[model samples]
Target: MNNEQIMNLIQEISEVQAAGNYVSFTCNNFGIEVFVMRGEIKKSKEWDRTFFFRKMFSEKRTEEMYQECLEYLNKMKETV
Candidate 1:
């Protein structure tokens, strides 16, 4: 999963293409979000920024969000 895969996943989520420093995908119900910020995952225990999160009504535990994160994170780690 490269940038292309991540970008495609983001599009699948129906995320709003808003202007911001970070690209965000939010699940309001679960209060979870996966975003790309400063070329890294936006949520890390070492460094986290969730100020822009908005609630999502979609039921989780589906392949949707997991695939997105897995692809993004896996590609990011591999590139490192």
Candidate 2:
């Protein structure tokens, strides 16, 4: 997906996370699961760093997404 699409997905995840809920979605060969645990947002590691990930998602984009998630997760944590 392009950066805009990825940002949209990130926004959706953030919304669900802020609401204290969980969401999972798959896009082409990529997928993500987001939820809260111990009052912090968390992402599932079910498909992280796997062969499929390397084949489907560019390392740069994947890291970008991860960093964005971390930023949002930390932002949420601070508000609690």
Candidate 3:
């Protein structure tokens, strides 16, 4: 995804979280699952065919999270 697309994804996720719901992002074989409520991340995970990783961000910042998502997406695209 491009910058605009990523930004839009972030916006959507934020909207979902604000509504007390969850959102997942997926492209090809890679996926990111996020659950945030009351400004706390209850669950966050990223996965691909080769690996599955989970993380909890106690001090998660939106910009940092989005940047990490972009990096992972870029890396996945490169490997494809």
Worst 10 residues of 3 by lDDT: 46-55
lDDT of 3 by residue, 1-80 (tens): 34575567666555544554434544333434443333233446432322222233333444566666555444433433
Model 2 error, position 55 (Å)? 6.1
Q: Write the per-residue lDDT of candidate 1 for residues 1-80, one digit (tens) a residue.
A: 23464466566333322322244565444454665543433346332222222234343543455565656544444443
Question: How many residue pairs collide in each prediction?
Answer: 2, 0, 0
- lDDT values, one for every candidate: 0.44, 0.51, 0.44
Q: What pairs collide in candidate 2?
A: none
Best candidate (score: lDDT): 2
* lDDT over C-alpha atoms for residue 53 of model 2: 22
Q: After superposition, how far is residue 33 of candidate 2 from its true place, in Å?
A: 2.2
* Candidate 1, superposed: residue stretches over 4 Å from native: 1-30, 38-56, 60-62
lDDT of residue 17 for candidate 1: 26
Better of 1 and 2 by TM-score: 2
Residue 3, model 1: lDDT of 47
